[model samples]
Target chain A: MKEQLYGLITGILFGFLLQRAQVVRYDKQLGALRLCDMTIVKFMPSTILVGMLGVYLLLDLGLAKLSIKATVRKNMGSGLNIQQGRFSLQSQP
Target chain B: MKTILDKGWSPYLAGALSGIILILSVWFTGKYFGASTTFVRSAGLIEKMLNAPRISKMDYFVKKVPKIDWQWMFVVGILIGAVLASASSRIFRWKALPDMWEARFGHSRVKRGMVAFIGGVVAIFGARLAGG
Candidate 1:
């Protein structure tokens, strides 16, 4: 129950941010695809780096325990929960 | 009436705020904020309801959607939120199409629509192939 509330709060915060970023805008998404504006690219690495640092710090301090992510299951009955096949991480690949 | 939410916030600030929210979601719930998948699901349900064969056979379509309908509730929420925001921001320029799109496809509305439809299919299919 607590975890679900945590998730809802996070969703609200995230949604608000999405509204602000204009990322919700199709133009920015297309712009990133077109390479006309690299702001999104710049933001991606920063966000990942920040998250990684927080994770590493938590590990070092023994404040948070991390678990291996569940491996992508082959037959999850429905494809909904399954990882949508793997492919290159490159943009416009 | 149309002039409500006119002030645009700084994009950088907005981007940072977005990043913070995304990071928080990951930290708390272990999920990323993604609406495209929801869109994929909604489109699937709609096609299923209409009995569209093209939607059923494509591996790309099948993989991204849920078996049950109404799985796209979040997408509905997004649309509602956007509508509210537009109404609030006084930026609610309700056009059937945006001007930038006209620049891309010229005045042939049907051509533009077909191009958009086909482009979306290719984009999602290509993403599935390359992402997998």
Candidate 2:
């Protein structure tokens, strides 16, 4: 119950942020994808950096531990790689 | 209402806020931001209701059981939040088609709907294929 509540709060915050950033707007997304607007791109790196730094900090403080689940590894290894390869091939002229 | 609904926050400010929220979410819940899985789960749920046995046998469904989890609730929150934001912004207007769609497609509802449907299907299919 507590966890679900936490999820709900965070989800609302996330959604608010997305809306404020105009990411929910189709025009904004299309502009970002086409490289016409860099607003979304500017935000992406910051999120990645913050998340990465937080994880490392937690790990260093012994607050968090890493567990590489077998299924996740397998899915990434077979599913993601094959999909990437196919997409790259298709994108070529 | 006029003051609050006039304009949006600056992009940089919004981005900074998003970054902070992302960090907080990770720190508190230990989950990354994502909504694609919710869509998959939704599809799985409908399939389950129609043909439980067949859906259960599928490998994807086996791995990703369709239950209302945190991510699903998150998506619901997203919908609610979007509606709230739009309402506050005074930009909440009802239209079957948006200006951009009508401008590009010349006011053809069928064409617009078809294109949007196809785009959504392709996006979901690609997201699943990429293991998103």
- Each predicted complex: what DockQ? 0.16, 0.38
Chain A TM-score of each candidate structure, as shown: 0.63, 0.66
Q: Provide the lowest-lDDT 10-residue window in model 2 chain A.
A: A62-71
Predicted candidate 2, C-alpha RMSD: 6.5
Candidate 2 deviant stretches above 4 angstroms: A65-93, B1-5
Per-residue CA lDDT of model 2 for B1-132, tens digit only, reads 575544566666766676677667666777667789899999999999999999989998889999788888888887777777777677766788776667777988898889989999999899877667
For this target, which candidate reaches the highest TM-score against the unseen true structure?
A: 2
Best by lDDT: 2
lDDT of 2 by residue, A1-93 (tens): 766676677778777766766767777777788889776787677666666777678778876555455668997899989999999999999
Docking class of 2: acceptable
Number of backbone collisions per candidate: 10, 0
